[model samples]
Target: MSAQDYAEISTLMQAYADGLYHADSKALRQVFHPRLAYVCATPGDELHLDLETYTARIDKRTPPSETGDARDDRVLEIKLATPQLAHVTASMALMGRTYLDLLTLQRTPEGWRIVTKVFSYVPMEKS
Candidate 1:
């Protein structure tokens, strides 16, 4: 990613982490589209979440404590195609395990926003 792209991705990723940590729907709404798509693979199963489902779920979440479960150390490695479309992968440690969230973003008139995301942990094989 170019410096400009990197800067944009960093800002957006921070917004994502903040949204989850603070459980702020407005913040989340700024980073993602209302029609966003998501896939999360946890130990139990591979789950899919659409826009409305994710909105409802996020709306119901309790924000993490100030000092705990505040996701940090996000690293975004991005490859951009025309600066409008890019693939980004970021990692952070939440709870006791390291999780990676891969995001696909497309620049819209509003700005660069995530369109789809896949959330999963670093599998145990690496641990």
Candidate 2:
């Protein structure tokens, strides 16, 4: 990938973090594809969320930034499998717990957008 490609992807990833942190649906929508598939494996069942459902959940939540909650987000790695396809791994702290997300991206005409996100939530130890 070219430097510009890397930069654009990085920016999109950053937007994802910031969007979630602030509960900004518009910002989140900008980075996610319209046909996004978000998957998560919980203890008892798995969750499969479409874009609309995800955004609806976001709309009902209070943002960490507004609640004075601490959040940490980091991009672990990004691998470009093809000119138009890439995978990114990221770590994020939310609600005092950690989560690891694997995001699949596709280079669309608009830009690079996240097409799929498979994530696992890590329970924090009691202090």
Candidate 3:
């Protein structure tokens, strides 16, 4: 892949992380595709969310910064399937839990946007 491609992808991923950390709906919208499907599997069942629902949830929450929580986000890997497609693995911490997200990205005329996100949450014991 070209450096430009990598940079574009990296920027979009970073925007996603920042959006979650700050609960910035505009930033989140920029990084995610309008038709995004965010999925999370828990112990008993699975939950699916579309873009509007996800953004609404974010809008209803307090920003992590306001809650005095330190943000932790890392892009673990990005595997390119083709010039127009890639799969990204990333980790982020929220509400004392760590989550690993598998994201599928597509390159559109606007830029790279996350089309699908499947994530798992890891719980932590309280002190």
Candidate 1 achieves a global lDDT of: 0.78
* Greater-lDDT candidate between 1 and 3: 3
Best by lDDT: 2
Number of colliding residue pairs in each model? 0, 0, 0
lDDT, candidate 3, 43-108, per-residue tens:
664899999999999999899978988788999998889999999999998878889999999999
> Model 1 segments beyond 4 Å from truth?
95-97, 122-127
Looking at model 1, residue 73 earns an lDDT score of: 55
lDDT of 2 by residue, 39-98 (tens): 996566589999999999999999989988778899999899999999999999977678
lDDT per model vs. reference: 0.78, 0.93, 0.91
Residue pairs in steric clash, candidate 3?
none
TM-score, every prediction: 0.82, 0.95, 0.95
Off by over 4 Å in 3: none
Better of 1 and 2 by lDDT: 2
